[model samples]
Structures are given as C-alpha cells and as structure tokens.
Target: MNLALKDIRHGLFRFVLTCFGLGLLMTVVLAMIGIYNGLVADALAIVKAPAADVWVVEAGTQGPFAEASSIPPDTRDAVARMPGVAAAGAITYQTLEASHAGRTLRVYAIGYELGRPGGPEQIAEGRGIATSHFELVADRKTGLLVGDTLRLGRDRYSVVGLVEDATNTGGDPAVYVTLADALSIQTKLDPAAARVQAARGAEPVKRPTVAAVIARMEPGADVGLLVATVRQWKHLGALTEAEQEELLLVSVVDKARRQIGLFLGILLTVSAVVIALIIYTMTMEKLKQIATLKLIGAPDRTIIGLIVQQALILGGSGWAIGLALILTVKDNFPRRVELEPFNAIVLAGIVFAVCLASSGLGVRAAMKVDPATALGG
Candidate 1:
C-alpha cells in the first residue's frame, strides 16, 4: 500500500547511501548549533563561577572579557573594607600556552585570592587549590590529570583538582593559580628586557595588578549603595551579576554569535536546496513509472503522498545517523560541543519541516506526468 516503501526497497542500496550522505550534512548543521551553545556556555562559565554580587573594574570600562580593565592589587582590600561589602577578592585572567607531555596546551590562567569568591563553585575531581603558590585547579578539558605537573612561565605548578566545562570565552581550558603566582607570571620580564629597563632608569614594576575585583554583599545590603560607593572611587566601575552576564553575552560575543547564526542559516539553505534537488532527480528518474501510474488513473493525492512519505523517511534516517555521528565525535573537538537532547529534538523537527517543504518540487513534477507518454512507450 505504501508506494514510497516499495520504491525505496527497489533501490535499497542507493537509498541508504543517499541517507548516509544526507546524514553527514545533517551532522554538520547540528554541530554548528551545538557549537554556538558551547560558546555561550564557555563564555559565561567564568562569569557565573565567582557567584559574586558585584564586579569592580577600571572606571569607564567593561571588565576583563569585553575590554582590558586593570585595577591596583590593593583595591581588593579597599573594596572589602567598604560598608556593604562582606567579602571581596581580586582576580586576574589571561590566556597562555603551556608545554605538557610533549604538547602545547592552551589555557586560561586565572589568579584568585585564597579563601575568595573566585574559586570554582564545583570541583569534579580531587581538591581545590590550597597552597599560596604553585598549586592549580584546572579544567579537565585541558587533558590534565590530578597529579600532572604543568610549567607556566618561570614556574612549575601541580594540578590538584579538576573542574568540568570550565573555559574562557575563546574555549580555552581554565587553570587556576594563586594570586602571588599569577602576579609573578604577569610582572616577570624576560631577563634581557628587565636589564634594559633597569639601564633606562625605568621604575620597577610596583605592586601587582588585578583584572577585576569580585565582591559579595552582606545580608540585605543595598546593591545601589555599593554601586554608588564604587562609582565614587573615580578609578573603579561596578556591574551587577545581571549586568555582567548581559555585557558578556550581548556586548562581548554578539558578533561571533551573529556570525555563527549566519553560518547556520547558510547551512540550512544548502540543505534545503540539496534535498530539493535530490527529490527532483528521483522523481525524474521515475517518470516512466509515474506516467504508467497516471495511465492507471491514480489520483494526485496518492502521488503527493508518495513524495511526502519518501521525504519523511529520508529525513528521519538522516537525523538518526547524524545524531549518532555527532555524539560519537563531539569529544574529539578542541572546543566543547554540547549537543543537548532538547536542541537535537528541536533540530530534528525543523529538519522534518524542511524535508516536507523540499518535496514540493518533486510533487509538482510528478503531478504533471502525462499518461499519453506511457501509451507511447
């Protein structure tokens, strides 16, 4: 009773090959979606990890992520001493490549004060940083084990703990170091550069600097008051948690997000065009059979059903194959590719809608088949 199933069975091998090819395309489209989500997750990981009520940065600038903003290291102490501030910590972030096991690993170096708000909220393995220097809590995605020793500029560090899904906006794995260690790395110049600076009568690098200050408020503290206090400092600016997240998601990565959206759009358009072309070709290949069916008095709806059923089968098959492929290889990517079930479901539904839409070309062609052509044959 199902003409589509009969036709597919008649060319089972070709049909399956077609499905496989289409599956690969679907995988690419789905991967793009997953990648965009992963980018957001990575960019926000640091923003959310601190769980701070307010962020204080250089006045008139968005902190670390959007733009460079540095404050005096002692600002942490000053902010902590503020009226509404229960606790404050100075943190710094930068990207660096470190040698590990004969490979260079790109990592986001974070300097957090001990007993501070900037430590990761969750540890997936071992323990968090406890020592004042040369200890690290690294993201597991860095391919680091708990006991692995990593060498950063002028120092060797031991990985004490591992966190999951922690990365900078650029998708580099995050590594935590003590404020002192980070300060040394930041200020220590090449020996030659330091010698030249000294000869040039350059002032020695003063106290260490921090990228931003994270603060948590006392119970029922007025955030407006804290913001007002921070604003008055003349050298500091503050953003609430909501404002920080918005700034990162909207203002920071907006361009990259739009580019990814455009890429996804192009991919969808290509998919639609390919599906339409394949269906149109399949209908053309079966023109003689279609003409015979028309001569036998089959209705237009039956022919339409045939095209729709075939499209659904192709779409479903490709979706299944693509999902399996993506899941299998997602971990192999350098950056995180988070393929959530909900996202997959939504994509599958959209794919089906596209498949139906693409079948229109074939349906129209099939409907125009002439019975007289079959009689001539």
Candidate 2:
C-alpha cells in the first residue's frame, strides 16, 4: 500500500549503502564543528581556571595567551597591597621542550604561587605541589606519571600530581611548578651564554620576572574601582574576566575560527548538492514506475512524499552515524573535541533542512513525468 516503503524494501541494500556513505560525510562535518568548539574552549581554559576577577599584565601588550606580555615579578606584591585586592599572585607562562623518560615533551610551563590566586583550584590526582623546589603538578595529557623525573632547564623536577584537561589554547599540556622553578626555566641563563656575558663585562643575568599578575577581588568588591586604581600605574594594564575572554576570541583565534566556519559552510553546500543529485538520479530511474502510478490516479502529493521521505531518511541516518563516530573517538584526538548537546541539536536541524531542500530536484522530475507515457507503453 505504501509505495515508498515497498520501493525501499526492494532496494534495501542500495538504500543502506547510500546512507552509510552519506553518514561518513556528515561525520566529517560534525568533527570540524567539534574541533572549533574545542579550540575556543581550550583557549579560554586558563582564564577560567584561575577563577579570578582581574588580570593585570604589562601595559600596551595583550597577555601571553594572545601575544607576548612580560611584567616584573615584584608587581604581585604591589598589586596585593592595593585596596580591594583580596589576593594577588604572579604567573609566568612559557612554552618549552623538556626531555623526560627518553622522550621529548612540549609543555606550557606555568609558575603559580601555591595556595594563592594563580594555582589550579582543583587537583585530579595526588596532591598539589607542596615543596618549593623540584615538584610539579602536570596535566595528564603530557603522558607524565607520578614519580617520573623531568629535566627542565638545568634542574630536574619530579611529577608529583596530575590534572585532567589542563591544556593551553594550542593543546599543549600545562606543567605547574613553583614560581621559583618556573622563573629559572623561563629566564634561566644558558650557562654558556651567561659565561659569554660575564666575559663581556655584562653583570651575570638575574632571574627574569613574570608575564602577568592574577588577582581576586574581596567579597562584593567593586572590580571597576580596582581596575581604575591599577590603571594609574601607567606601566600596567588590568582586564576583567569578560574582557580577557573577548581578547582571546577576537585576537588569538579569530582567523582559525573563521577558517573553520568557512570550511563548514562549504561542506554543507557540497552535501546539499550531492543529496540533490542522488535523489534526482534515483527519481529518473523510476520514471516508468512513477508514470504508471500517475496513470492509476495516484496524486502528486504521494509522489512528492516518496522523494521527501528518502531524503529525510538519508539525512537522519547520516546524522545518527556521525554523532556515534564523534562520541567514540573524540577523547582520543590530540586536541580537545567538545561536542555539546546544543551543537548536536543545531546540526541536526541543519541536516533536516538540507534534506528537505535537496528533495526539490526529485520533486521537479517526478512532477514532470507524463501519465500518457504509461498508457502508450
């Protein structure tokens, strides 16, 4: 009684094969969207991790996450002494390659004042660094395990703890060590270079300072007032959490985000064209059958329903398979792939609309089939 059902049942293998192929394409599209979300999320992770209200960095330079920013380490004490400042800590960030366990690891070294504003708020395993020297809390993605010895600069450090998903915007794993240790690695003079400077009568290099200051506000404190006060320093800049996030989104990853968006648009366009072509081809193949049905007094609506049903089925199956694929291997990806529920819902809606629009080609072909041709044949 149902012509669409009967047709699909007769060509079950082909129908399923088409869906499988379409599913693979949809999976790729979904993965790209997930990657974009992951990129933005990872970029903002450090700002979110600090849970601070104010970020103070060198004046006229965006923080290191967006660009190079360096400030004196002693600025933390100055900022802490300011009115309405609940706590202040110095944070230094640098990208370094360290050798550990016979492997080279690229890590973002963070210098956090333990038990202060700059340290990670929570630890996933073991304990936060309790010693000032040679202990580290590293992101698990670094493949670092507790008790593993890492050679950073001229000193050796032991991984004392691990955290999950604590990666920098570039997906590099973060290694949290004491402020002193980070300072040494960040600006530690190359012994050979230091000797050369000494020979040239240049004073031996002193420890370089931090890149930024993270500060928390007291309960019910006015952040605006605090920032205005800090701005008077003339050599420093202060940003609230919202401002920092905006800077990252607009400055740090804008091009990448736009690039991904353009790719997604192209993929959707290609998908629509491919679906329309497939439906149009299928409709052409069944011209005689459609003519016969029309001659038998079947309505145009029935023909339209058949084509639309196939499109919907194709798109729906593809979406399901794509979602499944993203879930199965997302965690294994080098960079984070965050597939949120809202993203899935929006993608599903897009595919549905595309399927409906794609059916237009088949609808036109079916509507043009002549009932007279069936009687003559």
Candidate 3:
C-alpha cells in the first residue's frame, strides 16, 4: 500500500543499480574523511611518542621537525639539573636514503640516549639497540627486518629492533640509534674533507652534537618557570609538549587539511546534485500515478511521505554500503585511514539531511500533477 515501496519494487533492478553507483560515490567521501583524520593523527604521533613534558631546541627555531635546530649535546645535563626537571636526554634527527638488499629506502634517523627519556618507547619485535655503534631500531614500514644490515652514510648498521607507527609527519619511517651514531651519520665528512679543515687551521667539527634535548617536568612543576630558567641559557629554546603538538598539527599539516576539506565540500555538493536529479526523474515518471491517487482521495501527506521515504531509503542504503567498503579496504591504503565511529555517525546525519532537503524538488513536481491527467492516461 506504500507508494514508495511499490514504485521501488516495480523497478527494483534500476533502483538497486542507482543506489550502487551512489554508494560508490559515498564510499569515496567517507574514505577521504578518514584519510584527513589519519593524516593529523600521524603527524602528532612523533610528538606523542616521546612522552616528554618539554622540548629544548636551538633558540628561535621549532625543534627537530619543523625547522633546523641544533644544540650542544651536553645541554641535557644542564636541563636536568634545573629545579623542576625530573629527567632530560639529548635527541637528534636527520633524514637519510639508506640501501639494503639492493633497494633504497628513505628513513628518518632519531638519535637518543639508550634506556633514557629520548629512546624508542616500544619495540614490536627484536630488542632495543644493545650496542651503541652500528645498531639500529627501525620502523617495520621501512621493510627492514631484524638481522638485516643496511648502509647509512659512511657506516653500516644492523637492524636490531622493530617499531610500529613510528613515522614523522612527513611519513618517513623513523630509525632509532644512539646519539653518537646519529651525529656522525648526520654530519658525515669524508676523510678528505676532514683533512682539508684541519689543514686550514679550522678544528674538525666534533663527533657528537645533538639537535635538541627533551625534558620531563616533575609532578606539579611549573612549565612557565622552567621555560624562563632555560631561556637565560641564551643557547636553548624550550617548548611544552602541547605547544609542540600544536606547531606540528597547525603549522605542518594545515595546508593538507585545507586541501582535503575543499575536496570533501566538492564531493558533498556533487552528491546532493546527483540525489536531487535522481529523485526528480523518478517523480516525473510517477506523475500519472500521483494524479490517479489524488483523484482517489489520497491526501497530500501521503504524497509527501512517499517522496521523503524514497530519499531516506536511497541515502541510508548508500551510507551503509560506503561504511562497509571503507572498513574493508582501509588497512590496505598506503597512508593511514582512521574512521572513527563518531565521524561515521556525523556524516550519516549530514547525508540524511541533504537527501531530505534535496527531495523538495521531487515533492514540488508531484504536488503539481493535475487530477485530470489520470483520466487522459
């Protein structure tokens, strides 16, 4: 007795085909949203991984990630002695193209104090770097497994451990090694280059200098006071963890987020137009039936119900299909795709509202069908 159900059943194949196509489009939209969320989450993971209270870098620069930052390797000792500091460690970072098994891999090398504040917090497999020299902990994404040896700069390193989700905002997998090894890798000078510097009466750059020192404040410690104290050193800059996260999230990923948002808006607009046109065409095909119902005493409410129900069915089915597809293939995506439950619920609400609003065009056309038209047909 329901006009919407009867009409859909009458052209079930066409309706299913149309819904399938719309579902594909919806899947893309959902995936895009997930990808954007994943990007932001990944960008913040490096900052979160350290679990530090404050980061001290070279003055006037955002440490290690956003800009060039270098500080004396011994800065950790000074920062740790400050009143509110609980622990401190020097950390260094550099990007390198490493070769293993005849294939090249790009990696972000992190130098940290072993068993200290700046080292890898979790290892998925193998053991943490047991030997300081030439031992490395690599993210599994780098495709380097335990016992695999790779050449970095002028030295060779053996993969000693594996870490998961340990990548920088730039999506480069992080390779962890000792602070000394990182400094040597980052500032690689050939013997010739070193000899030239010595011959010119310039001291060869020292072997071990770190980029930054990370510190954890004691419980109830005042970050403002600690920052003020560190500033007096004149060679170091300090940032609270929250400020570092904000710098990476807002300053590093801002353009990518905006670009994704613009794409989402365009996709939503296209979806609305497609839904509206589909409903309008379906309504046009049923004009004679609508007129007949009008002549037979069907109320305006019944006509409105038919259009709204059809729209709901279309949108609801599409949403379900899209969600399923996103879940199934999300893991295979190159970059992470994080589809949270709340995000799904919100997108569903938006799609439903859009469908309902779009059905207005169909409702208007249906309401104008003259009762006399049924007699002519």
Best model number under lDDT: 1
* lDDT by residue for model 2 (168-248), tens: 888899999999899888766888999998999986677588888988989988999878888888999888889999999
Alpha carbon deviation, residue 35, candidate 1 (Å) = 0.8
User: What lDDT does candidate 3 reach at residue 114?
Assistant: 79
Error of 1 at 351 (Å): 1.5
Decide which is better by TM-score, 1 or 3: 1
lDDT scores for all predictions?
Answer: 0.89, 0.88, 0.88
Indicate the residue-level lDDT of 75 in model 3: 88
Report how far residue 32 has shifted in candidate 2, in Å.
0.9
**What would the per-residue lDDT of candidate 3 be over residues 1-377, giving only the tens digit for each residue?**
88789888989999988888888888999999998988888788888888999999999998777787978888888898999889999998888897777788999898998767888898899999988799999998898999999888899999989999888877788999998788888776889988998999976765567878999889999988998888877878988899999998788889899999999999999999999999889888888889999999999999999998999899888888889988999888877788899999998998899899889999999999998889953
The residue pairs in collision within model 2 are none
lDDT of 1 at 135: 90
The better candidate by TM-score, 1 or 2, is: 2
TM-score for candidate 3: 0.93
CA displacement after TM-score superposition, residue 136 of candidate 2 (Å): 1.1
Relative to the unseen true structure, what is the C-alpha lDDT of residue 308 in candidate 2, on a scale of 0 to 100?
Answer: 90
Better of 2 and 3 by TM-score: 2
Ranking by TM-score: 2, 1, 3
Candidate 3's C-alpha runs over 4 A off are 191-208
